[model samples]
Structure formats: structure tokens, C-alpha cells
Target: MIKGDSLMFRGRLRGTALWGGSLLLAGCMLNIFLQAASLGMKFGAVADWVARYPALYLAGSLFLFFLLLLFAALVPGGYPGPLLAVAVVVLLGTADNRKLATTGEPLFPWDLMLLKNAGEMRHITRGMLSPLWIAIAAALIVLLLYGMRKLPKVRMRLTWRLLLGGVSAALAGGFLFVVGSGSSLASSLHYENLYWNQKVNYTQNGFLFAFAGNLHQNVMEKPDGYSREAILRIAAKYGGNGSEAANPAPTGGTQAEQDAKMPDILFMMDEAFFDPTRLPGYSFSADPLVFIHGAAKSSPSGYLLSPEFGGNTANVEFEALTGLSMYFLNDGSVPFQQRLVKMSSLPSIVSILKQRGYAALALHPFDDTFYNRNRVYPMLGFDRFTSEKDLPKAARMTPGGYISDLAAVQEAVRELRASKGPAFLHLVTMQNHFPFTSGKNGPNTIAVSGGKEAYRKELETYAQDTKLTDEALAELAKELKELPRRTVAVFWGDHLPALSAGIYAEAGWDAKPRLKHETKLMLLANFDIGAEGTGTLSPAFLGPEVFRRAGLAEPPFYQLLDRVKAELPGLSGSVRIGSGGNEIRKLTPEQEALLSDYRLVEYDLLEGKQYSAKLMF
Candidate 1:
């Protein structure tokens, strides 16, 4: 009997060892598969990565394997746990791939927030997942479910299962904490967190590791010596006792007369608008931006240094409205989804104009739920918000199924005409949104040459769409000219269109970081504010410049921005265009002082206490 019991125990131990070894191997394979998928399913690239940085790759695989182990331990039958884990990783990897293709940036943690509006974002995500792909995914899921059902279940004692799960969960949790918290262990292990350029980070480090690093992104760290006293001192220097010294009223009018003369401001942030004529070694059949070129000749127009590339329109809009620099925040964060929804009110151009008796209104020819704009607009101090649902069917018509820019402009005009007081209308058009396919706009009118044959369709489609936007702009300028009230319009593109990475590479735009972020900016008005010549400026500085050009009293924060604008005209996360269009690699002492003050004030307003809130805004 004793000999029989000993043999039985040995058999059980062998079975457990085999099961554990198989689970470990499966987890490692899944991790490698996910890593390769992140790099566009290039297994040779994964091999090259392993050959180059074996230790880092090993560590990443171990982290992922431990997570899989924890998931396995959670279930009574281990087969379903690995299946669930695979599904989760596959979904994330597919999303990251699509986002990278569209936006040139990998998926960040904040992007998960957009999943809440998945139904509303069909316009952008429509062609990403085709029927074939969906069918394949469904088949795979069904196969996995069948396999899970057929697999034999391992029966373990309740106490042993609890211990196994607790141990695995602890190990997974500890690893993430050590790595994410930037502890000495993470540093000693040579874990690099390259959050700034996530594309390279994901390719070099494993995607799972790179993505996990962003889980604890502190969007804006508090500036050094950030205190109420420091904020007060900065405010005292630039606030100027709430006087409009930085932006004095126009010479011809009293204070009240200046207030009355303030022009109704309209900001039209066009979608994916750019001058294709600027592309080197390429010729268009006709000038797609003819009207805009003529308008820019006399208006305050230049390349607006956008903070985004192909997507994330809200970031550019945030900078233009709030005078806040994305340079100060994390690279991959969306302030609208991540920060603004948490705040009750934010000091912005909308709030400033509202304080000056201008009725603030926001109009976007898209779903309000996108980027949580419906919730964010009110916090930004807009008195009214208009979205696609608010418009009539005629106003919402577009060849690409997005609302047309002409219709959006007409809506803006209607709102301005109906308003009793001076209005500040911000209209974000959706006509030129992405997925520039052939015949989407009913036969492209624009012809393109001198580029790869593969990109010709996208190029022609984008140019044709841009031409429509230019026509809309011409119509808007004509309407504004006929208005009885003086009106000023700030028209600009949020970013360059994602017309295939090959086009930008062929044009040599990818060689320069600034070229990828630069977009057309024009300031037009019925009355001349004596603004002329093309110049480069950051979107953050555009708000204060608009206030100054409008001859309106700027709040203290904008006055401070005006000073910073003189020193650092164009600023973004990657590059800074200093005074006279020269890029500044290093700042002078005076520029440093100015930048420090600006950082302090920004920190105070955004992350620190509300010390300068009442004084600045």
C-alpha cells in the first residue's frame, strides 16, 4: 500500500510539470506573436530585435508571460484563460496597427477612452475593418471557443487553486508596479521609457512594455518651486494690474466705444487642409487653394506649427482656444478626453470673450461625443454647443458622408446673425476628414503628377477635397464682407492629411520634423487690422495674437503669452521656431527666464492651485 501511494504521488507531480511547461511555452509564443503584430506582423523584424537586445526582449516576454499566467490562474479551467488573453492582445494589437497607419502614432492608454464613442466614430473607422477581416475574426473566435470547450479541465483542490492564483497575481502586479513606478529595479534592468516618440519606443522596446510605460503618464509635472508665492510673482510681472497695456484699445475709440467696435470673431478650423503646391517635385492640375493663396497675400497668414500630425484635431483646437501649449504636456495624451472632462471650468479664449460680453458658441459638424467634446465645451465656457445632430439633414450633407464645410460655414453665419451681442463662433469642419479613397467625393477633379503610382489616388482625392474647402472659404469671405458688423475669421488646418507616408517621404517632408507639423494659417477680416506678411507661430500664441490684432483687451495670461511669443514664436513638442523663423536648439538666458515664467504660470493654471485664475482670466 505504501509503495502504491508513492507511485501515485510521483505520477501526479509529472503531470503537473508537463501542464505547467506547456502553459509557459504557450504564453511565450503569444507574447512573441503580439510583439511581431505590433511591428506589422514582421517576424523577421522580431528576430532582429531579439538578436540586437536579447535581455530587454527576454524581460518583456517574461512580463507578458507572467500576466498570462495570472489570467490562467483566474479560471477553474486554464484553457479558456489563455484564449481570453489572446483575444485581448489581438484586439489591442489590431487597434494599434490601425491607429499607426492612420495617425502615424501608436495607441496610447488615453486612446482607450475613445472606445466609448466607437459607434459615433464609424466615419473614421469605417473602412479600417472590412467584411472579410470581420469574418476571419469571427471564425477565429468561434474556433477558439470550440477548442476551449473540448480541452480537458484540470481539477485542483480549492486551497491549492487559491494559492496558485494569489501567487501569480502578486507576481504580475509586482512586476508592473516596479516597472511603471520607475523604481531602481526598472532602472537597473535598463528599461527605457521613451514616451516622447512612441513609434520608435514600441519598435525598440516590446509593444507591451512600451504601452505599459505610458499607463502612469503624469501629463504635466508641477514646475520646480511651484508655489502660490511664485505664481503671484509671475502674475505681478505680466498681469499688469488687469490693465490692457500689452494690447491697448484701438486709437480711434473710447473704452466702451472700443468694446462696441470689437469685431465678431469666427474661427474655422478646417480638416486636413494644406497647400499641396508646397510639395516639391509635384504639380497639380490646378491650384487647389487658389482663394486661400489670394487671401493669404493680404492677411496675417503663415504656417501654423500644429502640435499634431495626421489626427487628434482636438489638441490643435485646445491650443488655439486655451492658449495652452501641448509642449508642456505628455506627448500622447488628449487633454479633452483625459483632463478637461475632470475640470469644472478652464481659462480660455472662450471664457475671456464671454467675460467681454461676447456670446461664446462652438460648432462641429461631427458627433459631440467624440473626444468628449459635448462635455468639454461647456467647461471651456461656451454658452452654446452645436453638433451634427443639431443640424438639419441638408446642412449635414457631404459626398464623404461627413458634413460639408460650406454647410458648416452657413450654420456659423446663421448663428452669428441670430446672436444679439458680439459672437465668438468656433466652427470645426469635417469635410476633409481622412480615408481619402477614390470616388469618395464623386470623381476627383484635381490631377496629380510626379509621385508614386500607389499614392496617386489618395493625392488626387485629398487635393479635390481641399479645393472644395477653398471654395467654402471663398464663400465665407464673401459673406463676411457683406455682414453689417465687422467680422474677423481665423481659418487654419488642424494638421496635414495622412496621404500615405510615401508621399511625405517622396517630398522629403519626413526629413524635417517641422514640415510634418506645419499647416496653413490665415487671419481674414472685413476691416483691415493692418496685419500682413507670412510668419510662423505656435497655435498657443495664436489666441493672444488674435486678441491683439482684434484690438481687444487681453487677459493677463494672454499678455504673458504675448511676451513669450516675441521670444519663442513657434513651439511644439518636437521643435521650437524662435523669432525670425529660426529653430532654437538652445535658449539664451533671457529666453530661459521667459520660458521658466511661462512654465510656472502654465503649471499653476493647469496642474497647480488656482492662484492665478482670477488674476489671469
Candidate 2:
């Protein structure tokens, strides 16, 4: 080859390389800017000021650059890496925005599971396809395809390309280790002052870095000085009598004498069931929950401080059955996903009942695997779980596409009757699951005065369905009253419904974060079991309290729970209920002292070694 011709070829190659490099940098910058803007827009601002935070911008950019470079090395043709990077950033931004809009929370890895059942969630996804998102997605697709074609292809040997790919992979891993590890690398990257508050953390640091922080956050942090010794001490302090402490015997003679006395205990969690009067200035014609109000007066009834609102029913069920609280665990982490798999003996009320020769049956009017409850219930000591598969679909009544509470109660009663001995039956009702748009509005007995037209319509639907739940409860009470054997029934709402923001605003209620966490609880017995205590109770305490009010001896774990309940009548992720039944936003020193011990015990039982397991569980 002639020297002049070779030199010209070399010059052209260098020019192409320079242009390709420039294009890659531009794509990287655009991706970074778009991500920052998306998060900033959530808080009502553009991310123009991110220029001032050079360190953060560099950290995010460097991470994206490594990802793009890795893609470049793997693909033989021109700049597939840059295009892919842009696509990734846009997808992430869109998902986060939609999630925040729907759930009032940021997107986390756990939420990805919801997408697998996307077909079942048309009610939610129908309104999620925003025109703005579609426009941005279309624009990104054009840029990606154009850039992929227009960029010059770099001619490199296979060996050299492979080496470059290796190097890029290593650098990407190192960058992730530093920033995502949430340790020294995160500290060096100016991420030292991080907390579990996803919104605040995501706003301060961009989505990529904040998501890394969340990955670390899911690893349950061990409380200081947590050990078997500490747990034993705490349990001894609170665990009143040993598990052998005999509860009030039924009709039988001695504690050892087992006979016709044991009441068939039933627990029913009504979906989105609560007294509408709890809302300020709210009035309903003829009082939909009138039966529930009268029942509460006769039984032990008050508001329950649930750990979640709107959804996450399994978590509430977990606490009631296992006597564990989500307040001490990682936020947004579902127990059925994380801890239930590892659990051997999840000291549940069912397990306690099983030990006393009672059959533990779980009845749900939905798919068994919605929350992995089909597997989780057995782990929690349920002998049998009756889901939609086991039931006759024709007999199932779904008012709003959810099984009616009345049907669930009827099922529970049937199971109780079938059992020759006492049964611990837990029925999780689904009459009022969200998207209150199904079935007829049903007479419109309840009216929502203030709110947007759409919001008011939703409230009316929710109210009507809730009234159905109330009637279902009354029907169950009547059925149990007619039973030959005495029975005790505990009815509670798992959480409040996810009503629109406008309805909350129109109600003139406190905008405190914990304002919606409280739901109603009622304990009714067919026969007298002495005076029933009436006040607010936490879900973890509900099982123990039922055993207590029913004159049944609780296990050591429930004994500690009973002690904790006396001091803190109700506890939730956001609110604390005092002995006087007042929901306080902040904890007092004394309340903290009471809760600290309980927290330590919970840690030992759930995350730490089972030092107190023998004593408690």
C-alpha cells in the first residue's frame, strides 16, 4: 500500500472515532439529564440546578458511562451502547413516575412482582397510560434507532473487542460495588447521610444511586446489643407466665380436662371496612355500619392501628397470626416474599391453637397465590387453606369482582360446623378490594357531599360495599348465636381504602402521614367470657387479646404481646396508640421505653438468633 493512501485512511478512521466518542458522551449526558429531570419534576421543579451538585452528577454519569461502554464492547456494530442506555433511563423514569402517582410511593424492586400479574390489574393500569409518557417514549425510540444507524462502525479485531468488553465489565462492577454497596464507596460518592425515606433520598441523589441505597436498605438492620442474653432478659421482663400458664377452662373441669367447653374461635378481616363516621363532618343516611356500632357496644371494639393502608393485606394477616410487627422491619419488604421462606415455626395463633388440639383452617375468597399465602399459610401452621380453587364458584358472590364478605362468613361457618372439635378458622374477606367500580352502586344510601365528581362517585361506591360488609358481619353473628356450641368472633379491617387525594382534602382532615392508618376492630362472643376490654388494639395484639378475653391461656410469645399491648394499645408503621387509646404521631420517652423492649424481642424472633424462641415461640 502507498504511504499517502495509508495516511489518508488513518486520518478518516481518527475522524470517525472522534465523532463516535462525541455522540456517546452526548447520549450519556442526555440520559443523565432526563433522569434528574424526571425525579425533580416529582417535587415540582426542573433539575437545572443539578449542575451545582457536580459530584452527584459525576457519580451518576460515570455509572451510566460504564454501562454504555460495556454495551458498546459486546455489540460489534456502531454505538448500540448509547442507544440502550437512553432506553434504560427512559424506562426507569417512566416506571418511577407511574408508581409514585398510583401508590404514593417510589418504585422499588419488590413492586416488580405486581407487573407479573398486570393482566389482573386492568383497573389500575387503564388510567396509567399517560400521553406525556407515550410522547417521551416515542421520542426516545426515534433517537435510539437514528443513533444506532447513523453512527460510524468501529473496525476492531475480535480479541481487542473482547478485551475491551472485559475491562468495561470490571469497571461497571467496581462502580456498582462502590455506589450500590452503601458503604465506603457510597460514602466517598457523597451518599453518607442516607435514610430509608425513599422520596427524600431519591430527590437528593438521582434515581440510580437512591435505588442502590434501597437495595442495601432491604437487608434488615440488627439492633445494637441484640443477642440471646438480651432477648431472654427482655422476654423474662414481659413474658408474664410460662406457656404452661392455664387459661380459663371451657365447660371442662380441670385445665388438663379437655371437653365441650373450648369455643370455636373465628377471625375475619373485612377488606376496607371502617366506620364512615370516622371521617370528619361525614354523615351517612341510616348509618350503614349501624349493626357494627351496636355490636361494638356489646363487645370489645375500637379502632385498630394497622401497619399498612389501602393494600398489603398479607402483612396485616402476618402480624395477627404470628404476632410480629412491620414497624421494625425494612419498609416495603413483604414478609411472604422475604421471611416466610426462612421461617420454620412462625409462632402463630394457628400454631397455638393446633397445640390445643384445634384444627387451624384458613379461608380466602381469592387465588391462593396472590400473596403466596397458599405456601405461607401452611408455614404459619394452618392445617388447611381453602382458596377459590377449593370453593364452588357458583356459590361465590363477587359484588365488585371480589368475593362478598357474606360468602366468606358462610364458608367459615360451614368449616366450623364440619370440625368435630374446636376450630381456629381465619377468614380474610375481600368484598371491598379497591377500584370500587364493580357491580351496581346499590341504592346509593350513603352520599359523599364534598369532593371532585369522580372522587365523590368512588366514595359512594366504597360506602355501599362497606355496608354490605357490615351486613355480612351481622349475619355471621346471628349464625354463631344459633350454634349449639359457644363461639368467639373477632372482626377487623385490614386497612383503609385508597381513596383519592381530593376526598381527603375535602374532608378537612389532618394531613399527617399516619392519619389514615387507623381501622375499626370488634370482638364478639356468643357466650359470656367475663367483661371484655374495649379500646384500640394493634393487629399483633389482636390474636393474643382474643385468647385473653376468651379466657384462653396464651403461649409465652403472646404473653409478652399482652404486656406490650397494655402499654401501647395500638401500634402501626406511622402511628402509636397510648393506653388511653389516643393516636399520637410521636412517641414520648416513656412510650419509647415500652416500645424499645418490644422491638428488641421482635428482632430476636424475626431477624436475630432464636434465643427467646424456646421461651416465647
In model 2, where do residues sit more than 4 Å from their true spots? Answer: 1-52, 68-91, 115-118, 121-165, 239-259, 281-286, 392-400, 438-445, 529-533, 583-590
Best by lDDT: 1
Tell me the deviation in Å of residue 539 in model 1. Answer: 0.7
The digit string of per-residue lDDT tens for model 2 on 237-256 reads: 75533344233234446543
Estimate the TM-score for candidate 1.
Answer: 0.90
lDDT of each: 0.81, 0.71
Candidate No. with top TM-score: 1
**TM-score for predicted model 2 compared with the true structure:** 0.85
Candidate 2 C-alpha error for residue 224, in Å? 2.4
